[model samples]
Every structure is written in C-alpha cells, then in structure tokens.
Target: MRPRFVLPAAFSVAAILLLVSCNRGDLPGKKQLESEQVQASPVAPVVSSKVVEELPEAAVSPLTVEQRLEDFDYMWKIIEENYPFLEVNKRLYGEDWLANKEEYRNKVAAVKTDDEFFRRMRFVLSGLNNGHTNFLSKEEYPWFLESYIRAGLGSEPWVNVFQQSNVLVRYNQKPLTEQQQSPKESNNNVNSGETGSKTGMTSGNVKKVIIEPDQIAYLGTRSFAGNLMEMDSSEIRDFLIEVKDYKTLILDIRGNGGGNSSYWRNNMVPLLINKPITYNTYSLYRGGDYSEAFMQARRLSEGLLPIANIKDEQMPNIPPEATTMFRNYNKNVDIVTPYQSVGFKGEIYLLVDSSVYSSAEGFAAFAKGTGFAMVVGGKTGGDGLGTDPLVAALPNSGYVFRFSLQMGLNSDGSCNEEVKTVPDVEVDPDTSKPLLDQPAIKKVLELAASQ
Candidate 1:
C-alpha cells in the first residue's frame, strides 16, 4: 500500500504566519537601545569632536607564541572572534573570560615540552563544549580528517556505530571501509581485522550486544565515515551479494549520522533488485499559497511524492529507474520504494537513537511517518530540520563560525527546526549491562518469525 499525505490550508497558513513572525522581530527596538547606550557612555560624546583616522589593515597569520601568556591571549582572542555559538560562549565563559584565558596562557608557558603544548590545546578546545568542534591539529589527525577540517565539517566522514570495545550492540547494513593504519599503533581505535563469514557474526570490538535471527540480516554500520563508496566498494559489493537472500531487512541507521546517501543507491540498493519501483516525493513551497484552495489545487494538479527539501542540492530531474536517475530541487528524499524492488519482499525496520541526527534522523522520520519502515528506538538528536549552514573564518583569528540560513519541513509542512523525531516504537538502552543494548534486533526477529 502507498503512503498517504494531505496538506491542510489552515496548517500551511499558520506555518507561514509563524515564519513571518520569526523574520520580523525586535530589530527596531534594539536600534533604539543602541542609541541610548551611545548617549550614556562618556566616550560617545568625545567621539563627536575627535577626528578618527582609519588604520592600515594588518597582515594576518597564525600566532607564534614563545610564552604561555601569549598563547592564552591568542586563544581567547580567537574564540571571542570566531567561536560558532556566540551566545553559548558568553553563557559559559561569563564576565571575566579574558582573565581566565590569560591565566591558561601563563599555565601553557610554564609547560616544558611539545607534548605539554598539545595537552594544553586539547584542554582549551574542550572549553568550547561542542561535540562537533575540536582541536586536533593537522599533525595529530589522519589525512582524511585533516583534509576534512581544511574543508570543514560540512564534508566530514560518515561512520556507522558497530562494535564498541568488543560487544555487539546493534545491526548496521551500510557499507564501511576498513582504514589501514601504520604499525606504530594509531591513536584512534578502529577495527582492522577479519571476522568469520558467519551471517550473524558478533563483533569482538563492540561494547553492546546485537543479535539477528535467521529471517533477517543485521549489519551494524557504526558510522558512515570515510569514503565507503570509493575506498571499499568491492568489499561492500561482496557483502551485499552474500546477504541478498534475506527477505526481511533491517537497516540499523540508529547510529548512522549520514555521509553521502548516494553510496546506498550505487553500491548497496542495486544488488537487491531485479525490477524497478517508484519512490514518492514532496514539493516544498518556501513561499506563497498556504490557503486551502491553493493547496487543493496544487495537490490535485501535482500529486504528492515523498521527496524532502532538506539539503540544498539538485535531485534527479527525471523519474529514477535502476541505473539512471534525475535531480530534484529538493536535496533529500525519504524512500517509499527502492528504485529496483524486485528482490527483498518483506518488512523493513529502522533503528534509531538520540545519536541519529541530521540527514539520518530525517530519513527515520520520513520512514516512520509514511510507514516505509517500523521505526524503533529513542528520540533523534537533531530537530529533523535541514540546516543550510555557512562557515566563516574570523579574519584576525583562524577560528571558524557556522550559521544556519535555511530550515526544512516534514511532510505535513511542520517545522522540525527545534524538535527531534520521536520513534514509533521507542527503545531505551538496557541499563542492566555496563554497556547499553538496543532491543530492536530482538523485536525484528520476533515480528519476522510471527509473519
């Protein structure tokens, strides 16, 4: 059965009105407050009589700090000039944050070795308090991550959560590339070994337990990190071909935070089909016509599809077949059907958690709402809205700040900017074990067996 969607006039109008309210804000009042501030400050009166001359622009470069005081001063200036979240920095650092920076710089200067400098930098970066932001200099990071930081997080690696510390926790089907590390022992602990060819082989590196019975296949992809498509396409192809026999499939994207969705269509989905199927799409309107008459007319003229305009990219221009596809103005789309759906005729389940964010959570929300799959897990991390973020590096300091410009909506045109997607079947991690476990695998087995 195809999924159903209906956009009501009242809801659309309300959303538009909300958008209008958000855009037109306290700017006029803020300007008035600024004028009052100028009147109150004694410097404001002196500025009128004094002729201020513009100084020549200074040449900018990375700081060379011989002393800890200089280093701390440099770091504070950089953060104050460029930290991504200004409000957050203010709240955390408070009134005399500069004094703290100077104090830290003094501490750094006291350090006797290069190791101490790195340790100090780590501590300084930690003060930012964002998971996405960190201070791993090019010397410390792998080539891929180094390249990514040079380009920024907008193009970071994707990873699926698999085995953590030698216990199986969940199932992931997304293909991954095994990174090769030098024998000196890499700092990051990623698996680089072969396991048995057993279909339900549990990972010795994982911390949690994930089990798959006979009916369904469970591949715990810890993340969509690195170049899965380019780096390890052959390994993924072989794995998918081997597991193509299963009817019921559970794509454990609970840990997938999304890299490039194109990899799924290319290396993975092609192996599962002998015939083609149409995935629905949605036409998102950024402006105009939230009225019932307009909505009805548009709906009647152009039937609703499952496409989502979360990303700002070109989608397929034509209806996609197995091999060739078209681009849409909408950046991302939820799958109602795979392009080729000849094989694998059974239920699909999506396992999610608070860690499931951005494009990953977007897909889960779509699948759950449209019945594409039975979503099982905890709330997603992101507010499900697409972020159109632009990163800017501070001129004097090499720090970068990213700000979101665009927001996206769900099928009903509801703004998911602040609210995350809640799972249909919420599964909490079992607290009994030192490591948490996902129950979706057990549930999928039971459902498949019953069927």
Candidate 2:
C-alpha cells in the first residue's frame, strides 16, 4: 500500500518571535498564562501574538465558520468513504458511525476560532481510537517545541545521559556522541572515521550502536522511517560483520514508530535468517464497490501482475481461472529468502516498549511468530492490525488527516487489534530512573547470558 504523504507546513514566524522574546526575558506573565490555559482547557491555547508575528502572512487570515464547516465535512466524507475498519470501530465505540458523524458535525458548526475548529475535528477523529488515524493542525506543528519545553520533557536530559555514558549516540539525524567526544577519543572506535563499507552511510534512523561491557551488541533504532532501511543497511550490515563474533545482539526498538515494513523484510530479516521464511500468512483488504479496481491498480502500480483484475462483467459469471487467481491474490503471503553469507548465526534479542508501533509492531510480531528473535520488554504500542492509511486534507483548514484503508491480519490469521504483541521476558522500564539506568537492560543481559 502507498503510504500517505503528509504535507509539511511552512515555518511559523509567530513561533520564532515567541522564542526570541522568551530569550530576551520578555512575556514572562503571558507565557505563564498560556501554560495555565493549556492545562485548564480541553484544547491547547491558540498561538500567542509573539508566534503570530513569525507566521507567514498567508496563515494570518481568520477562518470563517463556513470555511471550517466545509473542512469538517470534507474530512468526514473522506473517512466515511475510505476508512476500512467500520465494523471494528463500531465494536470499539458501540455507537452508530453515522450518528457520531452528525454529532461531531454539530459540534464543528459551533466552533468559533481556527484552533477550536481544529481541536473539535481532532477530537472527532480520536473517537476511532486508532493512533494511525489522526490530525496535526498547522498551528500545533510550530508550537510543538514550546509545548515540549513547557511540559519539561525536552531532549536535553536524554542528550546529557548519553554524553555522560561516553557512548556513541545518534538521534534526530545528528551524531550526538561525535559532537561531544574529542577527536582522540573518537579515533578509538570503528565508527569514528570513514571505514570501508560503512563510508558515506548516514545514520538516518539507526540511533545508536554500542557494544556493552558484556559484549552484547546493542543497536537502538528510533524509527524505520523513509528509505532508512536502504540508507542505514550498509552501516548495520558492516556493524554486524564486525561484531559477528559477539555472542548476543540486542536490537533496541523501544520508541520506534514504524515507517515501512519493507525495512525489516528486505534489509534486516535477510541478515538474520539462513532459510526462506513466510512472515505474513495472508493479507486481505475490505472489499468495496471499487475494491477490485483499486486492488488491480495498486498491484499494477507496484509492478506486480494483476492476476485478480476481475471486471464488473466478470463478477457474476467469473471464469474458473480468474476465480483461482483471485483466491491466490487475496491470500498474499509475504515470503523472504535469506541473503547468502549475510545471515547472523548468533542469538538475537529484540527490545521493545509501548512506543514500538506500526512497522515496529509488525517486526515484533514477526520475530515472535517465526522464532527469529526473543522479544524482551513491555508490550508493543499495538499498530499491527491497521493497514496503510489514506491521507486527506481539509478543504478550508488544510489540516491533514489519515485513516486506515484496510485491516491487516496477524501471521496467525488473527484480527485481534486489542491483543498487543507481548514480550517473551516482559521487563518494564524504571520510571524513577533514566532509561539507560533501567533494570530492563540488566534483565536482557542476564537472559542473553543464560541463552
């Protein structure tokens, strides 16, 4: 399925002005008031004047109630037509979807400001209880950093922790440890300079690779985003080659919000297995009026033969050959064969948490099902059942929204979205201490040693 492309918002001038003013020790009372309002109100407060000045002139125009209503209607229609898990959502919400739509539409009509309208629409989308289906308004995009700072959950602490440990770290497309460590200190490792095979390979989503004191190779991958699998594959391949002799490998995907499933199937899985494997038993989508055509087009676009391209005329009196092809096409089993001389022979351990979602959750499910790796840590964020999402933009607000177009079944042919992939050794993080100091790592190490 084609992943939805979310349009990036232009940089907000209002946000920049707010930051500058704050740096200059201005708007102390206003900042406090904004925080209080954010905490008290159901919706986040509107962007302050300081932020408004920084925003582009085009975004300053006030949205009319009619415009907001139109946007709401557009979003609602898209979800109503494209959203695949209506039965699942009905089971979840226990209300008629149409009734819920009417109720939200009435609420949308009453919204006055742009922020209020966005919030109401967001609330309506949240009713589906699907994280894959949601909205992020333009106003919320720029103020994300400010909100994080006010909430006291900035990245400073995490950076400090990694720096203090003197371990190589990469996050947010930057080399954190490389910047902190001296040239002399950095020269001691294989990753310090441009080495053959690892040369020109950007870290991308591979956050950190550190060989622990116990000789267990730990790799923290934050996301499977973009073409990171291809970008970071060489680095991981070379790292695995270098650490091939290590007894254990720890693939930490604690906070990995997944991107592409092909990452695991094509890049990672080949390096871990020596034989052919079937990761998904069967993949099917909800049939609709245009479902056959859609599937045919999708297959053709993906460079696959549209063997199940059943015509409207062929529906009632389908040919025997086409019927067989349709059955085969519907049961789309994902199979992969290992790369020669690239498979890892040592034991593999996967670290996960509730933040492990989307393709990450799929990875965990596959690993557990195939016995490819032993998962350790908390249950996954549970995004495996929802298929690829369809992106739609609001006509007036231009706010982007995504909803799943299909429901995926687990490897075992289960449609249980509520049942998250549990770890083999469930070790929760230590809330009192930093993640680096968590006992979970110790438990993983112990488990590895025992194995």
Candidate 3:
C-alpha cells in the first residue's frame, strides 16, 4: 500500500494493528452485519488535479452554515491528527485548541471557494519558515521538479566560466577555438556576426566545464537537489573512465545545496576509480518509531519476490516506489569510509558558498573531515545537520508542528549537529550581482591555475 501518511516538506511517520471482537450475540446475521460495519468507514478523498493555466476567478459558494462547519472540522481534524511535524504545529498554535480553531473557522468562512482555501493553507504552511515544510500534494512534487531541473540540447560553444567578485557566471558561446581564429579575429567575427560553420549555440548558464585544454575540470554544482539519484555512472563510464587528460579535477560545489547523498556515493564515486572500492562500516542512530508503514510494506514486498522458494538467488532488486517518502525517515545509517584506501589521487578543489546548507554542508564537511577534498569559497549557509521529524497538524487551524527527532553526523563522529562546515579556501565575494554569477567561475579558474 502506498503509505497514505505524508512527511510534508521538512519532516518525515508510523504503525499499528488492532483487532477487536464485536459483540454480535444479538445480531441474527452476524457475518453480514460485520461486513456492513467494516464498509461504513470513509476513505480520504484523493487530491489530484492538473494545473490550470490560471486559477479560476473566485466565486462564492452556496455552502450552508452546517456544510462550512463540516468542511472546517474536516480540515482541522486532518491537520491536528495527520500533520507529520508535531513540534512546528504546537509552537505556532497554542495549547488552547478551541480559540485557535475558531479563528480558522472564521478564515475558512471568509474563503469563497476551494482555491482560496488551499491558498490559505499554503500560507499557513509557509509560516513555519522551514525550507522542508512544503504542503504540496502528489502532483505538485513532479511539477516542481520539472520546473527546477531543466535539460538542454546541443553543445554550448562559448562556455565562459568566470566569477563576478564572488558569484559565479557561466556564459554560453565558444571562446574562439585555437585553429579557428585569434582573440582579435574572433572579436571581429562577433562584430560582424559571421563565423565559419556556425553552430547553433544558445546563451545559457554553465553547468560543468574542462578549462584550458589541459588536465583541469571545473564543475559548478548549484544544488544537490538535482536528479543525481536517477543517474547511473556506468552509463557515462566512457566520459570519466580515464582522467588521463585532466590531472586535477576542480569540483565547484560552491552553491550546491545538497540532495540525496546516496546518489553521489554510489554513482559518482565509482567513476573516480577504474577498479572497485567498498565503503567501510560507519554507525548511525536508529529510532524505534522509524516509519512502521514502511517496514510493513517492505515485509509484504519480500513475499512477492520474483524468485520463489530461493532465498539465495541473486535477483536484480528494484527500488521501492515510495522511497522519496522515506528519504528523511531515519537518522544516520552509515559513514562511507573507503575500504581499500585507493583514494582519488588527482588533486580536488571543492568550491562552496553561503547558500550551501544541510546535505550540501554535510558532504563538504565529510569530504574535508575524511581527507577527501579541500573546501573553497565563502562561509557556508550554516545549516549542517538535518532532522526529518514528523509534522502533526494543529487541532483546529492550518498550523503544523515540525521538529527533528534524529541527527546526521560527519565521518569523524563529530555531528555537524549544530554548526556549519567552514571552507578551507575562504574567498569573499563582491556583493553586487546575485551569488550565482561570474565571480564564482573566475575564482574557480584562478584557483585551478594556481594549483
């Protein structure tokens, strides 16, 4: 069963089974009565709707007083009992549920339609001011991902990677190739808009680059929340199989807000080595209430395995569909220590900035603390540790309670539980353009050249 319980944006929930024997002594048809009673309970309505180009104009609903109260009661009950983050809700709303509830009732009454209701709900969710506390429904998740992670076609020729003071800027368009023309000749061609064998290069931001036709690669990872999980390194083995061309790899994690580290550890790590490397043992905390629904689902899943009566058969495993819901369900599981110690000898330069937080900071800290890579850039965003707690809704209002139950720790056993990971190469930026501008790029290039 796709777990009906949700973790919202910033939190992560549980289990139980109850069996009660109904007193059917007086009933003539006991089985039939029991069946009827079982069917009486209601299933929550599914919220699924395609995005409209624009929200419909507000229209007054003809709901009666009783109907409005019923809807209000329904929303309130859902919030109070079902919201995963309890601490957040409790802090925002008070112990006196009735007074706060009445306020929501008035707000709900003022709403003319369902659209207004959800809009208010969104506002209430945003009140937590926590980045992870999103109130998006199932459909909204995919829509948000599609909007954020964009894919482009064709080779961007003029890839200018530079920094504007501190922010990084990646310009599209090939800086005239060696065989093509000199700097002056290319400048003239730009004035005339005439270059031989023109490639349809469009203006775009730089994602990654290999600079100076030499042994240095500069990568600009803006956020860790990209589709790194879906990528398999074997698919791109030919690309990084031999770093013979580039002796030094400058991985610009500058503004990369961390995402799923599993993707980085599993897929990206292998590319660094031509041979296999195993991760050493690391300890992580596990709470007893680490999602019972997930555990139950996992049990049911094993029984339906393809290979019957063969426990040892090495069958290709498929990841659970509900993995995302359990993404933040538990505390630390293991610290990835190299088993064989075949480290990536190529000098690595990690670029970072203030925007890097949570998982991004964790990765940077882990890399530096574990002697993986040297960190560069400005002071980090200072959000290192992450707590994926359950959110419980207020009894009457849209307020949600969020709190952390488990903590993530670095490899050295020092939990970045409260502090941010400071960078090794701390270069202050010019405070003019936004951080994601040319300044970051220039710094990375200059840093690589110096090394």
Candidate 4:
C-alpha cells in the first residue's frame, strides 16, 4: 500500500485508459468480449502497404489517426504495466499519473504530425519527473535505437523501419546500420553522439594531478561512458604506479551524466583498492511485456536478482516493485570490488555534485555506503540506482522510447532516485571553476591534509 499524498492540480493523464482497455459492449459475455478485444497480429501490426524509404517522408506525411492511435496505445500499455516510478513520482512530485489517462490519450489524438507527436509524447512522459523514465530527446532517439540492436532487439519487425533512417542519423554523423560500435568501445560522447563524455560540456577531460607531489593527487573524469581508461591506458597505468603509494587521492565526478557502470567497476575501482568492497543493494523489476522481452532478448535470468526479504517497514515511501524486489532479492547486488596489484594505502575521498547522476550516482552510492571512500561535495542528481533502461517502439513510426526496468534501492531500503547520496561533509563548490579546480574540492583536500 502506498502513502496518500496530496496531489497537485496539474495532472492531465490518468491511469484508467479507455483506448487501451477492452470494451465489453452492450452485452457482457466471454464470447462477445473475445471478439471485441483487439489482438496482436502474428505477422505485423496493421500498417500501410507503402514503404517509407526516408523517415522524413513519413514525417511529411503524418501517420493516419488510427495508426497514431496504435502507437499511442502501445506506449501507454508498456508504461501502465512495466514502469515502476508512477507511484514514486506522485508521492514525491504530487502529480497523479493514474488519474489522467483520458487526458493523455486525448493529447495523442490531437497530434497532427510526427514531430509534434514526438514532442507531445515527451510532454506526457515528462509528467513522471524521473530522469530515467522520461522519453528521449530528438537528438537522443536514433542512438538509443541503435543501442537496442546490440541488446538483440533488432529482430523486432518495427526495428526494420529504423534501418532506412536518413535525417535521424544526424547525431552520430553515421548511418544507424553503420554505427554498431559498443557504448564502452564506441565514441558516443556520453553514450549519445553529440556532446562527448570526456570531450563535451566544458567539463575537464580525464586527468590526474599531483597536488602535493604524490602525497595528495586528484583524478577526475566527466563520464563512465566510453573507454576512458583504455583510451589513456599507458598514461593511466603510469599515473596509478606513481600514485598508488600516495597518502590521499581525490576522485572527482561533477559533470558526469553517466554511461556504463563497468567503466568504473572493472576499470576504475580495482586499481586503487587493496581488497574487494561488497556493496549490498536491491534491483527492482516490474514483470511485464517489455521487461519479459528485454529479459529474454538479453538472455538473462530472473534468478540473477537475489531474493532480499527486506521488511516493508525498512523501506519508507517508494515504489512497491522496489520493495518487492528488495524483499525477494536472491543475493545482494553488491559492487564486489577486486584486489589490485597496485593499491592505494592512503585514504580516498570522492568528490561529487548534482550533475553526477545515473551510473556516476551509483558510484557515489557505493562509495558512501561501503566506506569505499569519504564522499564529499554536493548531493547527487539521483536516479542512479537500477539496471539499464528498457526499450520500446511506437508501432506507426518505429520511434523508439526507453525507461528504467529496475529500481535502485540503497542498503537501508531508501530509493536511490529519491534519497540521493548526501555528502558526509558538505562543501560548497565554486561553480565558476572546473571540477578539479573547484574551491570545494580544494577545501576537501585541505581537510584531508589537516587529518
């Protein structure tokens, strides 16, 4: 049971979906209901006979009302069933999503063009207020779809519509079919094509500096996306060798929006720590079409999430699925760290800010909870807990959308997204400077030196 929060008066979409729900009609019986309920086609969704060679052509000629209806219904159904944050959003933001289904469906009905349709869909999803649950931006759509292909969703029939993409390929400056590079291996900037992880956002590149000549050193990177360590293997290797015996190290992640967790887990963590650091946490999944298909497509097993058996009282206000996953977690989803040949015997401090999010936030969570590091700086951007996002395609346009499948919970049962990691020692960052050069980072260094 969820706590009753006073809802804000701005809700437009509700939970009762008239378009998605089946109509029982004047006579209510099993035979009549079976005939009236829409069934998924064995071959393909009902689409036009004409092939859309260029996506822009399809854009110019907006999909018919009925076709758009199918797409809208597809997205809504997926959200209704699999999205874990609906209740969470209502509790935190006072937007009751379940109370406005008819309004959302009407907005979909009023869409005249695909661009407008996309923006409107964005409008609808934004109501959820989750950094992970919202729809992708126009620039982010194609790259996300290409990513799904690697996850084995390419076999989907609607995915073929993306193969012929023209204008959609603008972000990476490469055709979707040709851009099969892995997130860690490929250059997606920050897993997108435009602004780079280490290159974009005016955030300083991945670099190591010896502030007090090896006694105190600092290393900062913008994203865990892309192969940062591998890209600078020799330099990083030499830096680690020089600094492993250092007294104190400051690991700064201020502007990192996130990418792959493995970038830090396997690449970053072990090189500094002497022994494994086990971080116990929960991973939540709302079993449904997208979750089921994603599970199968990725060739994963449900048993992967160890049963938690956590008490409802332990977890405060959060999504039920999050608690359910926690209580049923088979094993702790710990960030089991490995011992390194070159380890830092000195005290390590992690520097973070609101910009540090997603996988970056996960790192903050792990460090704060496991005593892996003395976490300092500002509060994180949150939404860091969870598995990779789940993918879905609008039937008419094959426009792919994604949201989180798993909810991340801290060891104490607080939702990672809601109860973001708070710095043990709060130091205000001088916003005018880069991450390493920030006065707050300097203050932390001073504190470490004093100790």
Candidate 5:
C-alpha cells in the first residue's frame, strides 16, 4: 500500500505536464523558515602540539561517545514524529514509547564502540515488534547479500539442497533420470540465469503446470515480487489458458515473503473472479503537520491520484472531514475490479505458511474473507500491518533504518498488525522434511480431484 501519489517516473512526468498547464491559484504559500537556534561550540583551550601527539589514536577516533549520542537523538526525534503505530503499539504491546526512548537514550550514552551503537539501535527497533522495521548499518550492507541468499535457501546449505531434491522426488514418486533442476527449483538457485529471484521456500512450488490424475492444475511460486504480469503474458498465461480446461486450480505460495501487491491485483485476481471486488476496506496514516504538508505537496504534484481503477459506483468516497486529522491525512479505502480477460471459474485452493507475509498476507486475507479460495497449510505470517515503510539514514554512522508510517485495516475494520491469517484446512509441516512434502498440499490435491 505505497502512497498513490508516489508515482512512477513516467507518471511523474505526466503529472508535471498537467501541473504546468493548470492554474496555480489554489497552491499554498511558501512556508516561512523558523529561526535556527544554534548551539555554541565548546572553545578549545590552547594546548601544546606535543601533548596532542602523546594521546592514543583510539582516543581521538571519529565515532566518539558524543557523536553516537547525536546519532541516537536524531533517530529518536524522527521516530517520535513519524512512527504511525504509536497508539496501536501501546494497545498491542503495552509500549510506553516516551519511557522506552528515555531508557534507550541512557543505553546509547553508555555505548563504547561502533558495533555497540549499531546493536543498541537494532535492539531499540526490535522493541517495536514490527518486522517491517529494521536498522542496517553501513558495515552490514555486505552481509545483506549472504543473508539474503541464506534466507531464501535454508541457513544449512546441505539441508536446503536435500529438502528441494527430496520434495521433488516425493511429489513425482519417481527418481529423475537426468537429475536436472526443474524451472521452479532452478529459479531459487542463485546461480540460475534469472535476473531477480523472489520468495523463500516457505511456500510450495508450482513452477511447471502439473496436471494431476484428476485434472487438477498446480501452480507454485516462492514469492510475489517480480513482474508477474510479464510472466503471465508469457509462460503463466499459456499455463493458465491450458489449465482453464482443468476441473480445479491449486495456487501454492507456501514460502512466499510478500512483495508488491500489484502482481496479484493486476495479474492474478482478474483471472480468478469475474466481477469487481473491494479487498482493502480502509487505511490509516500517521498524520501531523508534517504529514499534512507532505500530502499537500503530493496533491499539488499529482492531483487526485487514484489508488485503484474500479467502476465509479464501486469507489469508496472518503469524506472531507475524515481527511482533516493527522492520522487520516492520506487515508483511503481501496476497491479492486477484477481483470476482465481472466476466464478461469473453478474451485481455487491456496497454500500458505508462516513464511507468507506482508502483501502475501493481504492476498490470503482477501481470499479467505471473500470465500474466494479454500485456504490450506499453516497460519500465514501476519505482517500486513504497515504499508510501505519509509527509509531514513543515520547522520553520523550512515546506517539506514526503515519504519512504516501507515497502518492498514482489514475489511472488518480491524488493524492488520500482528494478526495472523489462519487457514480453513490446517496442515502442519513435518520438521524433518520439506514443506512441499506436508499433508497440506496432498490434501489440496485430493480436494481438487474431488471437485
């Protein structure tokens, strides 16, 4: 649920053209800059050059205690001003944000090294209990590549290979003659030629269309991050078109950590339902003077940007009074119309697991709430709380951190934060085996065949 006003480059160009052509009579006056309150620098007493040389190099390092304090203060101010879930977090976690800040500031003052500073910052962020929030230091950037790879595959290298090979063998019930990788398994491998790879192995794979004995079509992906529309236009479209003749469809997203929601909205949902639907009932933003200014800038740049293109009658008309407050600054209700070209109209089964998070959780929620699919597998990782997180950099250490400035609500008007989406048919995976070997998928196959 990224801001609609944050348009693509081409869209921004179009908006600029529109802005230039329109009258600027309604634009707000330029804000006056407040007078700066400058703090006086401590004066250095005259000292001998020889005394300075005698001091240890470690004592004169750039990342001094004072510098770390300054960094922490900067971070604290930003979160205090912008974090959207302050009240919701208090209700959910009993968090006293101001108290936590005071406690953490004391800890920051005690930090003796750069590593300690980073660790303490991470500890403070972890207290939020929001998976979307994280701090990544400059030194940790290189670690991201390795960590990402490990996250996709299991941390244990041998276990990942064994699990993938075992799942394939078990599902097909036949030893491969060539021991070659299937497109789905190949897609997961870092060495594979694909440009971008998404998803961890939490979800089962539906790489190649496997038509079971009773005309059940199985389609699996590890993630929902890439250009699914292009994938659909090419191989997926061909597969779905072929599968339209099948009796039932099983869409697997077992290990998927969510990506962009548009992949499902624009490419998948249209193929499933014949009519328009409302998925997201409402959304809330952390509004303040800053947010108001931000929204005004966006509105000026991109006038009345539509979140989704639904029929006129289907749109949720948000009242002007609702938009007046800080929390409701950019709040919106989303209405999605199905893609008109999709023709599949059969029983749909969705496979989910703890790895399914963020936008993927939204999919599971929508499907379950709308009775669109019979959800199977373990409860999905409930991470649909905050929309897109806003990123900021630490002034001193150059470390980057992200925090969500908006909280989304379910169709029932409940906050999505920390609310796990349970499956209709629960199937726990065997710890010793791959998720694909779990009875959940087997049950889906059985149910699909019956349908």
Candidate 6:
C-alpha cells in the first residue's frame, strides 16, 4: 500500500465561485492572512489571479424548495460529520460555525438557480476559513471522486453517495496551463536563468552569488505538483552531481503550494542520506465518514482510534465540545534514503515563506520531525499534517465537494494548522526584493559559508 498521507484546498468566497483555484490545481504563490485579519478576510485564495481561467459553466437547472433544503441539509451533515476544524475556527477566528446552521440553511433555501446554489455552497464552505475546505467545481467533482477511490477510502457507500446528475459538459484538465501560456511559451524556462529541466522548476540562477552571501546550489520550485508524467529525473539527478561538493544545499520552496510528496521521498531524501528517518506525526479527527473510511483504507499500520488518555495538554487549545467530538490519530512514516556516491551530502537548508503550503508545509514538518534539514525563513501556510481532503456530495442534487477531515498536530501538541511551521531562523519575507534574495536566504547562506 502507498504510505498513508492525509490530504490537501483554497478559496475566498469570490475566488472559489470563479473557480479561481482548486484542491489539486496549479496555483503558484499567495500569502496567508495575518492572524489579526483572518476573521474578516476571505480565506486565502488557491489560484493566482495572474493565472485565473474559468471552468465551463454547467448546464445546470435549479432545485425546487424541497430539493434545495435537502441539498442544504446534506451539505451541512457532511461538514458536521467529517470536518475537523470546527473548534479551530471558533477558537482562532471567533467564527461560531456550529451556531450558523439554520442561517446557512436559509441561504441555501433562498438560492434560485444552479449557479446560485453553487455560489451559496461556496459561501458556506468558505466560512470554515480553511483553504482546504470548500465545494468542488462541477469540473472537479469527478476528479475528486477519482481521488477518493485512489486514496483507498472505502468505496461501497461514499462512492455511491450521490449520482452525478450533472456531469460537467466540457471539463478539460489542461485548460489552465494552456490559457496561461500558448504552446510556444508553456515550455519556456522559469524566470530563473537556468534552462535544462522543464518538467521540474529548478533553476541555476539560484546559485549566483548575490552581494555578500556565498554562492549556494539552489534547487527551488514554486510547486511540487509536477509528477503527472515522469518528471525529468535528470534535473534533480544531474543537479545533485553539480552541487555535490557545496558546503550547503538550499532547498528553496518559497512559493510552493505542494503537489506530490513522492517527489521528495523518492528524489530528495534518498539521494541525501544513507539511513532511514522515521517521522512520528499526529492528527485530530472525528470518527465520521472520512476518518473511518481512511481508517478502513489503512488500518492498524497507522494506529487505532479514540486514544484512552483524556489529558487536556495532549490536545490543542480548543473548546471542550470539540474534544468530545473528535479522536486522536497517529502515524510513523519511515523515509529510507538510498544514497549514491554522487548524491549530495552537504548540510541541507530548507528555505520557505508564508506561501509554502500543503505538501510544501509537509516538507517543513518532515525536516523538523526527522532532522532532514535546518528550516530557515518565515512561518509557513499551515494544514500540512493529516490525510488527504475528504470527499463529499450533496444527496439531493449530486453536488460534490471536499473538506479537511483532520487537524495536523505538532510535536509540542500545538495545532500545525494554527501554529504553522515556525522556522529555526525566522525572517519575514520582504516583498520588495526578489524571492531568492530574501533576508533568510542571505542570512543562512552567510552562515553556510562560515561553516
């Protein structure tokens, strides 16, 4: 079985309705809201406005009052059962989503068209304030259902949760890339001056000595979402040989929103080390559809549910009501690095920023958990730990959506989603400078040169 990794979300209300970004979409970089501003702000957007391309509109019909209410209640029930962030929302943002059930019902009841129903779902889902929690687009519903099955979630019931009464007429996966760039431009090098690998985005300009900072081998990417077809392994392979003798290796994933974790496990870790590193991580989730389905999907290999210890210290700061609603989950992932002679053995420094999220956030967590690297930079966008986003569909209308089903907990017992990944050497990203020239990279490079 593939190593169990819990899932990956974005939308402020408008961004989601416009289908601005997707759970598995190729959105580049966006900073998360400051803690002081989360409550009033829209959830951090998933796709970059620079690359916004709309999905084809569904030839959808409006639901009747009965149908609308049924869809509303079904959507609410999905959240109530599987969503893991209810208390986190209440505690962090002062948004009491649990109390707004009827209000959401009224909004759903008030929607007059399929478009209106879609927007209403977006509004309700965005209220959770998690980038990973939102409704799936008509185009993405089938995509997510495929993901759910691929994730090994129990197939019998939830797979049959609702029939696709409205199959999206013209869902094209390549549209975003195509719209963003013509065939001529799409394969061009990332703005970074290096040009060998189009499959992965590592650029050689990352190594240029800037000012006083020492020249460091920079293997950077804005995303790890690159494993659709075989990645040109030669990029990482040949780059490793090029930088093998450098004192420090900079794994710069500054604006990355994460994709395939396998990229790191198969490529980065194995090339760097001769030993295995076991990462013990924890999550908090309800014993509902997602949790239970995943539980069945990957049993005892992870651990049993409803841990006996009732200590408040083990749980993150949330209302007593939430603790009552959820149970603890834990897993130990062993990354066995397969080292080769030309593989990089230098000190690895992970460069990150607030835009580092999802699986990128997982890199930070893994670095911290297993001593894979010294993390340097700002706090990352959270929601890194836990399983893949859980799949759901409204029973009445076959309207599909997904949301986070678990809260990633840090070693210190703080919530990863709330605390984020705090760098060992923290530096706020200065937007005025080029991303690679950020203070953290400069500081760490100077430190790397000295050592």
TM-score of each: 0.45, 0.63, 0.46, 0.72, 0.62, 0.72
In model 4, what lDDT does residue 215 have?
Answer: 85
Instruction: Please state every model's RMSD to the true fold in angstroms.
Output: 18.8, 14.9, 20.3, 13.4, 17.8, 9.3
Clash count, candidate 1: 43
Greater TM-score among 1 and 4 belongs to 4
Question: What local lDDT score does residue 418 receive in model 1, on the 0 to 100 scale?
Answer: 32
> Which digits, one per residue and each the tens of the lDDT, describe model 6 over residues 1-451?
1121211121111111101123322321122221222222222323212222345554445578798788788778878877877877887789999799888888778767666666666677777877676655534443343333322333333344323333322222323234564322322221222334653553332332223223467776655543221243456667677667676777877776765555455556566664544444566667775456544543422454564453534645433543587765543334343545364556778887877777677778777666778888888887776545655666656566667766666666667777788887787655458745678767876778677
lDDT of each: 0.38, 0.51, 0.37, 0.57, 0.50, 0.56
lDDT ranking of the models: 4, 6, 2, 5, 1, 3
Question: lDDT value for candidate 2?
Answer: 0.51
lDDT of 6 at 316: 53
lDDT assessment of candidate 1: 0.38
lDDT of 3 at 411: 36
The per-candidate count of clashes, in order, stands at: 43, 7, 42, 18, 7, 8
Error of 3 at 100 (Å): 7.6
Estimate candidate 4's RMSD in Å. 13.4
Give a tens-digit lDDT track for model 5, residues 356-381: 77767777876787677888888876
- Relative to the unseen true structure, what is the C-alpha lDDT of residue 1 in candidate 4, on a scale of 0 to 100? 12
Clashes (candidate 2)? 7
Assess candidate 2 and give its TM-score to the true structure.
0.63
| Best candidate, lDDT | 4
Give the lDDT of residue 165 in candidate 3.
Answer: 13
- Give stretches of model 4 more than 4 Å off: 1-60, 145-204, 227-229, 304-309, 312-330, 335-339, 434-437
lDDT of 6: 0.56
Question: Positional deviation of 89 in candidate 4, in angstroms?
Answer: 0.7
Candidate 3 per-residue lDDT, tens place, 39-71, comes to: 211111221222112223333334454555565
